[model samples]
Structures are given as structure tokens and as C-alpha cells.
Target: MAQLSADADAFGPMLTIEQAAERAAEHITAVAGSETVPLAAADGRVLAADIVAPVDLPPFANSAVDGYAVRFADLAAAGETRLLLSGRVAAGADAADVTTENRAVRVFTGAPMPAGADTVFMQEDVGLDAGAVILPAGLKRGANARPAGEDLPRGDTALAAGRRLRPQDLALLAALGLTKVAVRRRVRVAIFSTGDELNEPGTALPPAGIYDANRSLLRALVTHAGAEVVDLGILKDERESLVRRLREAAADCDLILTSGGVSTGEEDHVKAAVERAGELAFWRVAIKPGRPVAMGLVAGTPFIGLPGNPVAVFVTFAFVARTVIALLSGTQPVRLPGLPVRLGFAYKKKAGRREYVRVSLAPGPDGIAVARKHPRDGAGVLTSLTETDGLVELSDELTSVAEGTIAPFLAYEMLTG
Candidate 1:
């Protein structure tokens, strides 16, 4: 991995969420969206290019159900027209011999319609005899016969580029007899936690110290968002160690993520390291619990340093880090899908920044009401995040929101696991 520049301040400004998003988008453009695989292997992957149907689906007129293929015109004068059974047609049968007029061909589901047959009448509507079957009333021409290219036309673009492969798309492609596909390559990402006091899970928690949770959270988050996560583990609060791990991460990973050690303090080696390797833009966001976010680059690798506080970690991960990841992955990322509800109590915030407040939506006289902050205020309180159902988004301009005020609450269920 390339060593981050020892001179950290040269990368650029500490970007806001919006600025980081733009840079991330630019970074994503550098990646080549080219990869090909089987249709069965393209699930959840973005299409590298448009997929044209190589052949018409079904490729020929076929039977839609178990019935007899017949010519509707031959039944004009009779209550039931008895016709000799020419042959039985089953799926995958290659027999293409044309059936003579007034002859009914026994056809099963998925069987290609014999040439010259214009209609199919259900078996239940036919009286089966030793050598022939009698077609009953209500039989119509062109009924239950699937026409050539009816499902899809030859050379038609069935799927467009930049679309994520879905289950139905896979099935459709499989039906077209396509064995492979082209897709956008996966985004490579690396994550590390910085703190001497932080310990990995399974280690004893000494007094005044805690196990590292942010890394686990981030790894889960990155994987869920469709990026591969390289675990860099926890780095002790040492500048030299931070630089080494960061450089290694930057060298191999397109995105390097770390939680903690970016704030303005002597121990904040992450900010210093990021500046030494790339650039750090500190964003003074209006959002509660996640105001301190660092967006920078390390050795040309985009470095996203989040807050050490657990609640802050969750907020920044969803709103800020997620957007960066999405942009890096060549997808347009937006805020969580929100559900409109009324605030149960009064709340206030300073203008010019967005706020995300942990809230528990309650049942009220009208409907679901948002109320009560999580018990803890420290950014380190992970329990506060788990206990809340969602976060109510408060715009910066609103100095105070009175009770019963309607607000947009982004449900935690929608944003987090």
C-alpha cells in the first residue's frame, strides 16, 4: 500500500456531505464498469451494458396449456367437430411436421404449436374418442396459442445498462438461453478502527475502556451496501501505526474508512494522518449526534473518518458514509425513505444545518407520534440508537418545533438493520 503523504494538508478542503458526494461521484467515474458472467450469476449486480434478446422468447408459437391444437375455421357448422389425433406434442419435442386441416394435435403445456393450427381448445371441452377428439362449443380461433415473439422480440433490448440484476431478470435471461452477462465490477473498500482504548470483541474490557463496536458496525454496513470490506482491525492511538495501516489500506482499497480520531485534539492522529496522506474536510453538519465528519483522501484513496461516538457512528454511517459509498459504487444514493408523522413534544435546533434526532414513535390520539430522546447524549451511546425506532430530521432553520408539529422521521428500520 502506498504511504499517505507525510504532509497531510495538501489533499483539499474537508468537504461537507454534499461536497464529499460530488468528489465520490468523480472518483467512481474512474472505475471501469466492465465484467461479464452467466445470467444465473448476475444477481444484484449492475448491468455493464444493455442486453438484447438474441432470439424471440419461446422462439415459436406454442401452447399455453394442455389442449388440442386445431383450426377454428373448420368448426363453423358443427356442435362438435371430430378430428383424428395426428400426434402428441410435448415440451422440447423437435417434431415440426405440419398437421393436416381438420386434424387435432395433442399438445401439452409449453409445446410448440404445430404449423397451421390457429387455436387451442381445453381438453375438458373436448370429447375424447378412440381415434379422434370432438371440439365443443365456445371454441374460438387464436385462443390459447402463444404467438412467436409474443413474450419478447428477437434483437429487442430486454434489459438496460446500469440496472441491478433482479430475480425476474435472471429468469428472463435464462429463458432466453443466455448463459452469461456483463456487470459493473464490485467496489473494493477497507475499514479500520483507531483508538488505544478500543479493543476487538472477545477481549476483556478493562475499566475506562470498551470493546470496538464501530468496526463491526461498519463492516456490516459496507457489506450490506454491496461493497467488499477489508478488515484492518483496531490501531492503537499512535501516529506511526495509524499512518502505516492507513497507507496499506489506501494502497489496496479504493475507500478507507475509520471511526474516531479525526476531531481537533492532540490524540486525533486520523485527521493528521489523512492530511499527511490526502486531504481532510471537516463538515459542520446541523444533524444532531453526527456533526463531526471527516471526508478526505489518503494516497488517492478516499478516506471517510467518522465520529467515535456510537450513535454518531450510526447516523454518519447511514447519511454520510452511505452516500459516499453509493457514489463510489456508481449509483445515485439518497436519504432514507421517510414516513411523515407528528412530533409528540417540543424540540429546537440552530439554523444552517440538518439534524437527526433519535426518536421513538409512539401511539397517540391521532396516530403514530414521535417522542422521547434516547437516554444517553454522548456520541458513544450505541444503546440509544438501538432503542429508538427512527430519527426525526430537523432542518436547520427551525429554531423550535412545538408539540404536535408534523415532521419527517426516517425510520430506523428503513435506515439500519
Candidate 2:
């Protein structure tokens, strides 16, 4: 593993959230590789190139309903007009030619529109008597008939590059008569957790030892971000062991993620290991509950160190690590999706650091959805994440928020969806 030159000391103050995100974006780049896969396996993958439609969607003009196809000129305005029935056309069958002006053909839904027939009157709106159909008054031309290329045209872009394919996107490709597509390869991530007082579940606990929740949270988050995870488990607070694990991860994976040992504690070893192995790009971000977040490179592989607190780990990953993962997967980074929702309670904090409060939706006085803050504010409380619907973000310049004020809210799905 080779080390990059160190220039992180030149940056003086703790960086804002936006500044930290921009720095991470500048350092990371998309992997330059792609593979062709069948449509069945392309869901959740990023597209490598634009997909153009091979042919029109419908291929030909068709009937959109079960109706009688007739020439609009033969219908009268004040009274019903009679037309001789020529033939019937069902879906997936050939259309009948109605050459006579006063003739019509019985057509089912999705059936092809007959030749020389300008419009269709729904069967329920007309009458049939003695092998002849009576079209009602006020017949409109081209009614209930779907024209060719109405949904999609040939030679047009169907899906753009850098788009993460969803279930609906796969259906569109199938409709375009495509079985396979080119997609970026999945990103490989290596993750681990560090602390002396942390213990895995299903084990007897020592005095003052707590079970490790950060590892499980981090793993779930990485998987939800559409990346392949290489979980390295929990490492004890030892300098040499941390260095060895990081080196191995850098050699075998595209990026490294670790929780704990990056803060300014005397027992912290991960930060020093990062500085010795490579360059610690930045360690402190101006955000509450996750101010100890760190980003660096270990032997050219990007590394992000999240705080040990479960709430902090969740918040920092949603706002920061998610972008890095997207970049590594050959997709463009997305902004934190947020919308304005009314506040149901008052909140107060300092102006320099940003904060995210766990909140659930409640009914406001004006019948609009309002955000109600959770009672617990500790970073180590994992229930704050599980019980709340999402987070309410407060910017750096703002200090206090009164009841009924509008604030930005981020849903959990917006982070992973």
C-alpha cells in the first residue's frame, strides 16, 4: 500500500457540512468499468449508457376500448345513424376493412383500428338491430382510438446514463424489446467497528461493557446504498491491529468504513493509524451528534470513520457516506432529499453547528402534517432512529425555531430509496 502526500494540516478550521461533502466529492471518482446483464438482474444497478428505443411502443394504430369502429361522416348529429356490420376484430387479430361509408366493424379493446374507419363509438353508447349498428348522436372523430407511437417513438432516448434502475425502469426496457443492458459494476466496501468497551451480541457481558450496535447499523446502511459489503467485524482498541486491518481492507476493497476511534480521546487509535498509513483528509465536521466524522485515504482507497454513537452513525452515513458510495458505484451523488414541514414544537440551539432532530409526523392545527420532536436527544439512543419517521435539519445560521414554523424534514426512504 502506497501513501499519498499529506496536506490536510493546511486546512485550519472545522469544515461545515456542505464544505465536507464537497471535499469528499472532489476526492472520490467513479469506477471505470461496466458489464452487460439481463434485464432480470439489472434492477438497482446504475446505467452505463443512454438507452434508445428500438421501435414504437404500439407498432400500429389500435382500438383503446370495446366499441364499434365507424366513419365519422356517416353519423348524424340529431338522431342515431344505422350502419351495416362488416366484420369483427379482437385483440391480437387482424383488423377488417370497412370500405363502405355506412358500414362499421365490431372491435374489442387493444384491437387494431380498421382501414378507412376514422372513429370508434363505445358499444354501450350505441344500439344494434338486425346485423346493423346504430351510432348515437354527437360522434367525435378519432375518439377511443390510440394512434401509433403514442407512448414512445423510435430513435428517442428511453433512459439516461447514471440513472439507478428501479422496477419500473426494467418494465420500460422490456417494452422497448430489450433483454439485456449495460450497467456499472457493484461497488465493493469493507467496514469495521472499533472500541474496547464494545461486545458482540449473544455473549456474556463484562462489567460496564455494552453490546455493539454501530456495526449492525453500519452494515445495514451500506447494503441499502447498493454496495457489496465486506464486514470485518469489531476490532479492539489496539493500534497495530487497526493498522493491519486497514491495510488489508485497502488492498482488497474499493473503500474502507470504520466506526469509532476517530474522536479526540486518549485511547483512540484509528485516527493515528490513518495518518500513519496515508493522509487524514479531514476529521471534524460542523454537525451535531456526528461532529467526529472523518474522511481519508488508505493506500489510495477512500476511508470514512463514523462516530461510535448509534444515532451519530446513522445521521453521518445518510448525509456523507451515502454520497461517497454512490460515487464509487459510477453514479452521480445525490443531495439529501428534504421538504418543508411545519414544526409542532419549539427548538433552540447554537448558531455555529448544524443539528438534526428525530421527529414524527403529527396533525397540526391547520390540518397539515407537522413534525414533532422525539423526547430523547442522546446520540447513543438507537431507539431515536427506530421510532422516528425521519430527521428535521437545522442550518448553521439559524438559532431558534418556534411552534408552527416551517423546517426542512428528511424521510428515511429519501436516504435509501
Candidate 3:
């Protein structure tokens, strides 16, 4: 992988998608800083330290249902047993001390069990007559009770470091009465789009100009990968402007991303600007719809250059850019989630490069998930992404796929999260 960028003419061929990802992971490193933030602000952030349970979950033994708390010894002794009604305990109320023989205490769900009670019976199962209660038969000991630390005990590791915080994690932290948590700092990313024919949205289009869609698409994807985006807007296909932005972004950002102007053409400035400002590590990957991807460093800040096509930007970002961003954010490299799905449509291809086809899922004859390729397979077809559910990844060695072949499927929801 290193030799692929060092020698120009000696380079044999483009690298595969897996090879590109491995090289990118080796080149990228995590930021070293961390901060303490409120739990509300910790969503999507990676944990910098292990989270230990400060106290036992549910801290005390409690009742799991609305029932009568009693001494199992009293119920186990004889044919028929009756107990005197002592008192009622609701959730958050103090537990009553039961000492006298054949006495029971009324307990509601989540209420602390009485000091001398060892069992519980549903209120409907026992008959309450006047001042005494007739306990039901066939009641088991230690039933309908939640013991202390049933979920998590004190001093135990609740969550390990490098784990991405999600909504359910916030709930768990809140349950432990944690107000703030230590987390790795968000990776700051500087992003821009290049091309003379690209214009901002809501503006009048020139003779051959089209609105820039790659910037918005990449910005959203970067932010979704747990990085804060610094939008540099659109730039012309000029080396001077591109170099200036690269230098400025390197000063404050951890990484830089540019769409378009990566290929070898007179209008392409990203490749030249990166070479002048710093170093372009490698370019050109052996993958369909996104063969001209570029990666490098600008003043020590990681840089990734994606193709100008909207769908190309999408596919390459899912496989390459997102993994780099994860590593840069003090976390582990996460591979795209893949599942096996039967193909409902037959497809043929040459066995040289990897390809990803937009597809939707349908129920096969055997009631299994089937991948149905979208009608449009063009790299510039943005509508195809919206119409499909995910992507079907084809390997470089497999030439054709039969209608019932089981292939790898990557869902759109997994790509962003």
C-alpha cells in the first residue's frame, strides 16, 4: 500500500476496497484530548474512560408485583394459614417491620420488601377477610421479588472505553445518577466542494452550472460519523484557492474533505493542491462507481478527496471516509455491517473490480429476504439511492450472480450510524 503512492509509473494497479480501508486505518490516528460533558450532550460521542457502577442497580430488595409480603415459613408450615394485616407499603415508602407470627404486609410494585418478609403473593391470590388474610396454596418461596444489584452491581464496569454513546446508554447513565460523563472530543472536519460548474442551491443556474450536492451530502455523512463539520462551502477549480483553504483547515481541524477535482485533468485542483500543501498518500481504488478516490495529509491533518458524482461520493464515503473519521475520533475502525440475503434478480459482471448495486428487499419464495437491484445503475443516479433500501456488495472474483444466490447486503441505516 505504501509503494502504491511512492512510485508513479511502477504502480501496477488500483487497490481493492478492503485494501484501501486497511491503508487508511494505518495512516489515521486518534486525537488525544477528552472532556467532561452532560449526559444530554454525550450522544454520538465516544467514551474516553470506563464507566463503573457507583451503586447497585435498584439498590435494595423490592417487590416485582402488587402483592402481599409474608414470611414463607408461615405459609409453608401447615394446611391452612391466616395472617393479620400489618400495614401497606407503596413505592418510595418505608418498609414495615414484620415480627409477629402469621402477619403480612401489603406491598405494591417496586416497593421495598418488609424486613422479615421472604416471599410475596399476588393480592388477588389471597382472600382478605375482615382484619385477617387467608394465604393461597401452591405459593413458592422467594417468588415475585427483585434482589439487590440484579442488573448491575457496585464497582463493576458498566460500559468500556471507546464505546459510542447511544440513547439507551444515556438512560443507563441516568439510572446511576450520573450528570456528566468523560468523553473524547469531537473530531473537527473541514469540508468543501470544487468545480467551476458547481453552484450553491437556491441560486440561479448558469449556462452549464448545476447545484452542488456533494458538500451537503458529505457534511451530513461526516457529522453522522461523530465528527463536527466545518463547512468551507464551494471553491473554484483553481490551485491557489484550494491550497489556501487546505492550509487554513489544517490549522484548526483534524481532517479535511474535498469533493471533485481529484482525477488527472486540467480542471482538477485537489490532487495538485494537496501535493503542494502537503502529500497525497494514494488515489484511485479498484471499485465500480468510485474508482478515483484520494487520501493524503494537509499540514498534518488527514485529507480525503471523493469523486464529483453524488452517488459516488455516497458509496466511497460509506466504505472509506466514515472508517477514517471513526479512527480519528478516538474510537476503533468499524466495518460496514453486512448480512447475507438471497438475490431475486440475476446479475452478470466481469471479475476484476468490486461493485455495489443499489437494491430493495423483497420476500423470496422461501420467505427469506431477497435483494432486488434498482432499475438504474448509473453512478450519477441520485434517485436510485432514495428508491432503494441498501446496497448489494459484489466481490472482485465473483463474475455473475444467479437469481437465488446469497450475497452480502449493506443496509442504508447501518451505513450512517
RMSD of each: 5.3, 2.7, 3.3
| Candidate 2 residue-wise lDDT, 77-139, digit = tens | 678888899888999897744453678889999988888786888989988899998887876
Candidate 3 per-residue lDDT over residues 1-417, each given as its tens digit = 111143323333587888777776666778878999999999999999999999998798899999888888888565657888988889999885545357888899999988878788888888888988888678778898887888889899998999989999999999988999999999998999999999999999999999999988988899899999999999998899889989999998888888899998888889999989988777888887798888878777888899999999999898878888888887876675589899888988878788898999987778779898899889889999999999998999989988988888999988888
lDDT of 1 by residue, 1-417 (tens): 212333324434433456545555644443455678877667767677888999998799888989899887777575668899898899888548857487999998888888788798888878888999988877667999999899999999999876657699999998999899888787788888888888878978898888998988888888777677888888888887787888888788878888998778888888888767666544344456776677766767777888888778888888778777666666567555577888776777776667787878777676666576666656777777778888888876788888888888887656643
**Local distance difference test, each candidate:** 0.76, 0.85, 0.86
lDDT, candidate 1, equals 0.76
Q: Model 2, stretches more than 4 Å misplaced?
A: 1-6, 9-12, 71-82, 96-102, 127-141
- TM-score each candidate: 0.74, 0.91, 0.89
Residue 60's lDDT within candidate 3 is: 88
Return model 2's CA RMSD, one decimal: 2.7
